[model samples]
Target chain A: MAVKLFYEALHDGLEEEMQRNKDVLVIGEDVGHYGGSYKVTKGLHEQFGDLRVLDTPICENSFTGMAIGAAMVGLRPVIEGMNMGFLLLAFNQIANNAGMLRYTSGGQFKIPIVIRGPGGVGRQLGAEHSQRLEGYFNNVPGLKIVHTSTVYNAKGLLKSAIRDDNPVLFFEHVLLYNLKEEIPDEEYYVPLDKADVVRSGKDITILTYGRMRYHCLDAVKTLVANDIDPEVIDLISLKPLDMETIVASVKKTHRVIIVEEDMKSGGIGAEVAASIIEQCFDYLDAPVIRLAGKDVPVPYNGRMEETVIPYPKDIVRAVEDMLALRV
Target chain B: MVQEQLAPTKYDPIDRQEALMLYRDIVLGRTFEDMCAQMYYRGKMFGFVHLYNGQEAVSTGFIKQLRPDDYVTSTYRDHVHALSKGVPPRAVMAELFGKATGCSKGRGGSMHLFSAEHNLLGGFAFIGEGIPIALGAAFAAKYRGTDQVSVCFFGDGTTNNGQFFECLNMAVLWKLPILFVVENNLWSIGMQHHRASSVTDIYRKADAFDMPGYLVDGMDTLECRQAAIKAIKRARAGEGPTLLECSTYRFRGHSLADPDELRDPKEKEFWRKQDPIPKLTKFIQEQGLASAAELKLIEQEIRAEVEDAVQFGEDSPEPPVDELYRFQFAEDE
Candidate 1:
């Protein structure tokens, strides 16, 4: 085992995959010589050469669509958006072309492309740059969504996303790049559409993903001090959700609190809460609570931005509120 | 200089066999489209059927220059493009009928025809969406050190899309082997090109990307074929992409449901008089390539082929209900 940062794990995963398959390539703006905007793809261009690690012009729509085309013709392309906020520019290609191509083509084509980049609020980046648009993509069918919270899951899930024969939207938190954790030295792959139980408890289930997973873990420490045993479930796959695991967890705990970085309205928390009610309605001791970003654009002020998104304090308070509720 | 660049370049005269081949392909396309229109009225086909009526020459001319391994992507008016790229008439007809035997297995009806075997990538429903895809295919060919080129066919309105400029810039910058063919049929649905476009000349826009641009007479198959030869040769030789604007006209409305009342009668008559099939027929006769009886025989053969395709489509079964749940993702091994 070796300790590695989240971004290093991602780079190692991509490098290993590229070496294993000649058809696997990376394409995006500054993915080649500049080593990616965040340096997650650092040293890949030198190692793989320009053909395999391509540097494209700052045209998201065309480059994303180009990746789709390359995927159609048997190339497994990993397209890195400089930031997930910029993915809005290529939404048409992602939702319309890459998302619908397989079904539209009647199972004749398989789009094996992974679009990955740092997403969610970071260090006072304003409204346009701080948005976590996973909810928008989660609504799209024919797309598998993955958001990892640890170096292990990040590397394992990213490897699986590259190997899977589908278009995957892999969202990484901007803040988590520097977070270090020990990962296995041997090659490993976590299957898509499965959730991981990070902590085991009985009083309540804490459902979250991406950057929220870390905040929820931080809340777990306070919950333990207050005699509240909360089970933290890191929802790695957003689409084709591992509801089986969630429902089982909810049934065991008899209460749930969902956390997300996206806005509260129409967020993934709403979907998970609805699923819990539908699947295990009778098992609930209290109504499912959602702790998500406030329904407002992220402001440039650092303190105000922190208030808008969920923090460890917010998660702790939400859990307390959920535990106090009566059936 | 832009005007000079748009002028048609001269080439060697087409031989008798090649001319006949062009005539046969165009005739086959027309025959198939006519059957599609008839089938739509008879209620055999569903959805908006965009027939490639007068624009046969554009697809035939450009596709003739492409090798079987070369890629072709087209717009919703794609039946003729698929036919020209060697997709079986029966498969395309079956697709329009939403039959399991169709090219896309009845999932992508009239708007989405794909044949990986023929390298016909797809028929995109949205305007200007296929250009970048074609560019990517060209990139793949170059990355693999292959001689194959990719051709993207779109309407004149597609030039207004942001990706059109973006893709053109990248295609030129990367020197990818691609041919962007704009089938400028004078209208995008009900809107006329001149009114919607700021600059009326579509090929001239290619100059902004520093790419070679040519405007060809879309009504004449021989002229379109000659221009396509030069463009394809340039692409295959790794000289990068060419933007070819084939100024054609669609005799029918945009789709079968359209009444086509927006066009001026006089203007429509002017283009109808330049019908590409008859123009090619005249050239064939003047060149003494075939007798009138031989032409009649060819027409009869194409009609039979169209009838066979219709029957094949009619006989094919609809996809099973379980297929609805399939193809969301590739089946796991």
Candidate 2:
């Protein structure tokens, strides 16, 4: 086993997939010689040449659509979104073309395409640059959404996303790129649409994924010190959501706290909370609580930005509040 | 000087077999579209029906130049384009009827028709969506070191879409083998092309991409075929993409729903005088390429073919309820 950074694992996954299939290619702005804005694709162009590792202009709409077209044919194109915020420019292509191509074509075509990029608030990147737009794509059918919280899952999940016959939206937390984790050297693939329960506990269930998984884990440690054992669930697949695991956890824990880095209103946490209530409402000791980013654009000021998104303290507080509620 | 330049050029000499084939294709398209309109009006077809009535020459002319493996993408006004690309008339008609045997398995109605066998990539409903797709198809062909060229057929309104310019820039930059055919029918729904665009001449926009551009009389099949042949040849030679703007007009409303009150009667009359079906027929007879009786017999055969397609569509079964969930994802193991 070798320890790798989250971004390095991503690069390794892409490199291995490309090596395995000649039809696999990477296309996006600065993905070739520039090695991507995040450098996750560093040296891929040199290794695979220009045809496999393409650098496109700043036309997300056309390039995204082009990747869809390429996917319809024999190629499996992985389009880099630069940042999840930039995906808004190609929203039509992703939602209209990629999401609907297989159904619209009567299953005649398979779009084995992945649109991967860093998302969620990072550093002091202002409103437009920092966004966790998973909610926007989660509502769209015919799309599989994957957000990895660890370097190990990043590599394994990304490999699966690259191989999936359906269009996949892989969102990586910008802050987690350098986070290190031990990954097995042997070939392995993480199955899509399955949730991984990272921590086992009995009192309260903490549901989170992406960057917030780390925050929830941090909060779990504090909760443990305070004599509260919270089960932490990492929701890797956002779309074909692993609600079965969540419901079973809710049945066991009775109380739940959901954490997300996106805006609180219409957030993915709201969907998870709703699903929990609908599935195991009678088993719940208290109402499910959500700790998400404040309903506002991520501000430029470091202090304000830090306050806008959820922190470990917020998760701990939400769990405390949920547990304290009398039912 | 402008008047002298605008004067009609001498017609290119076409042999009897080629002339008859071209005439038959145009007549078939015209006949097929007319049947579609009649069926749509009689309530045999549902949803938005956009007829390619007066634009037969553009599709027939351009598609004739493409090899069987060459890809073609088109806009919502795609019935004639699909026909020209070799999608069976029965399948196209069945698609309009939303039958399971249709090209898109009844999932896509009027606006979306696709056939992998014929390499008719799709008929995209969004105005300029097909442009980038065609570019990608060309990119795939070039990447595989194949000489297959892709053709994208869109209306004048599509030129204004950001994807159109973006695709042009990339197509030229990558030297992709693509031919963008702009069917400038002058109306995007009720909006006129000149009113929506900064420059009225759409072909000239190709110069911005550093690619060759040509404006052809879309009412003339011969002119369109010649221009398309040149563009296709250049693309096959790896000279990169070419933009061909075919100046044509739609005889029908934007869709069956429109009243078509936006166009001037005088302008309509002028274009009616240039109707390509009769124009080709006149040329065929004037050159003694095909006898009047022979042309009439061909027209009769086309009418029978169209009637047979209608029967096929009507006889086809509706998709079962369980089939509704299928085809959302590929069944590949």
* Candidate maximizing lDDT: 1
Give the runs in model 2 whose Cα sits over 4 Å from its true position: B1-13
Task: Provide the DockQ value for model 2.
Answer: 0.67
Best by TM-score: 1
lDDT of each residue in B171-255, candidate 1, tens digit only = 9988899999999998999999999999989989988988888888998887888888888999999999999899899999999
Candidate DockQ values, in order, are 0.70, 0.67
Model 2 agreement with the true structure over B124-218: per-residue lDDT tens digits: 99989988888889999988899999999999998999999999999989999999999999999999988999988888888887888888899
What is the lDDT for B31 in model 2?
Answer: 95
* Per-prediction tally of clashes: 0, 0
Q: Report interface Cα RMSD per prediction.
A: 1.7, 1.6
Q: By DockQ thresholds, what CAPRI class is model 1?
A: medium
- Residue-wise C-alpha lDDT for candidate 2, range A121-193, written one tens digit per residue: 9999889889979888888768989888898999999999999999999999888899988889998899888
RMSD of each: 1.6, 2.2
